[model samples]
Target: MKNYSILSVTCLIFASLLLVLGCKDDTSGQQNAAGQQLAMSLPVVEIPTKTLTAYVTYPASIEGVVNSEVRAKVAGYITDVLVDEGQKVNRGETLFKLETQSLNQDAAAAAANVNAAEVEVEKLKPLVDKNIISEVQLETAKAQLQQAKSSYNSIVANIDYANIKSPVDGYVGDVRLRKGTLVSPTNQTPLTMVSDISQVYAYFSMNEKDYLNFIQNAEGATISQKIEKMPKVNLLLPNDSLFEEQGTIETINSQVDPNTGSISFRAKFDNPSRLLTNGNSGKIQVPKTFEDAVVVPKESTFERQGTTYVYKLDRENMATAASIVITQEIDNLYVVASGLKKGDRIVAKGVSQLRGATEIQPQEIPFDSIAQPIQKVFR
Candidate 1:
């Protein structure tokens, strides 16, 4: 009986030892798995600020100052097209030619008649002076000479119209006609279009309130002075890339567009190389006026229902979604003129997963190259 009791006790001790060992192994495995799941690194970024020039962007289109479509005035078969598409042409330069054989013959005939009448008038003048011819005869001869001279001039003008010429110096657009194509005088089908692209114009619109404010402020200001100190204009290309150069406001529309509730405005830019052609659409940023402002990265803000919100890091590194009031600046960035103060740590990125009073590990990200430049402006 004692041996049986001892055996049972030994068995209980062995089972306890086995259970303890299994627990230790399981705990160590859990620790290893957790260590492996940890993030390899935390994100860090550089933040700096400087004074930045601000711009207000709007949609705009480019147009040449001088644009025209060259047309044929006289009807005839197109004998030759002197200028090719995209070729540069100058004023009075022949662009195309029409066969003017019939017109040329008429001119020649008129010239002969004028010469014969003039000769008869000269002979009759002497005869009238000598009283060898009556005064009425001399008068009749002079009238005939005058009429012939008028006819000659008319035919000469018609012959000149046979050659098509460019009225301005510019690049030719499309050559719609070819040699031997019949063209009509009334139908002035363009040979091509020409434009003086040495300077380009940009047209844009402003809201009625903005337009009113501008005029009231610029009432006594000179256009040149206004342009020099006037709001800075930034031009963006079709690719959404901004032009390195800036432009100046040239003119404001005489009246507001009733249909659109906006006032139109124009800007001028020197395009010496003719780089900006007609019909290019892009965005223009115009800095109207200044105000005491605070700005933030647009990505950090969220919109819910009708309000805009941002996530801010508290002392405990907890993200709290806070409501903010903002005004749009250049690009997609926003100016948080209110609802944020200096030195507040706002989540500049990755705020979508966060909620109010949520505990989170904060990671800093580098300012994008585009965003980096704007930081300097704030300082």
Candidate 2:
């Protein structure tokens, strides 16, 4: 009976061991199935092949195309000031009146002298013809008349100049001299300045390389005409704000500035709204050549160890980080020059949690939808 009990105990222990092994197998199978289900549910995005444009950007300043300094042309005291600072004046409009007391008296005297000389010359002509007066006397009277005419003309010119007028229709700047200030022809005083802001000028300097390229390609064409094919220029104002008015390329300097080592180029813009101003510092946009490039969302790109990289979604719905060479930027898009291929599935989202060769369930967020805020640039 004791031998039978020992065999029974061994059988029980064998059955118990089998049960433990079965439980472990079942647990392992359950874990594997769960993992497979999770993998299937992961999101993935397909790579896209898109065309992009290559552009070059630089810094530029805003300047007036027509700038003039209003200076006194005649010597006189400024008696009446007709315009104020920031007021617009038309060409030939009187901006100020100089005291004309001495000029008027001189003109009156000239006129009296001219009348008397004409009478004397007429009387002498008859006398000379009748031999009552010598030929020399007639010649002297004629000469006196001519002198009087010249004096009259000179006085008239001074009288006209007493009324200072604007040379062109423009906005008046600061009043350099107040009324009643004595000014002269040789004086360095300027009463005020008027600038034609209807169309302002912007000057910039480009390197010799750019100048050569521009001249070669822009043969027989004006800078304004060339810039018309490009996007409008943006202006940065003194207050650090952007001006809404767009500008165009206007002129190029005939010669490059020797001191600056660059050729000067100018731009113009319609300032009908009086929004733009002179001496404002801002940058402009220039269109360049087109290159075969890949553009990715700025958000999808990340930097590590001074290198730029982007996450790509593989066919197996896994997140893969790729090292890419960035060239230029357009708004929120990055122009990729190398290290990524067209139609290579890229992870456009979840970059914060991504790493190189990471196993993930990639969700295909439509690139358009992901970059909708920035994609609005097209619409």
Q: Alpha carbon lDDT of residue 52, candidate 2?
A: 56
lDDT value, residue 65 of candidate 1: 86
Sequence-dependent TM-score of model 1? 0.72
Worst 10 contiguous positions by lDDT, candidate 1: 39-48
List model 1 lDDT by residue over 263-289, tens digit each.
888988888766788888889887644
Report lDDT (Cα) of residue 273, candidate 1: 67
lDDT of 2 at 62: 56
Per candidate, the number of residue pairs that clash is 6, 7
lDDT of each: 0.76, 0.75
Model 2 pairs whose backbones collide: 43-362, 43-363, 44-362, 47-345, 63-201, 64-201, 65-201
Estimate, for each residue in 106-197, the C-alpha lDDT of model 2 and write its tens digit.
99999999999999999888888899989999999899999999999998998889888898888888887878899887877577778887
Q: What is the TM-score (0 to 1) of candidate 2? A: 0.75
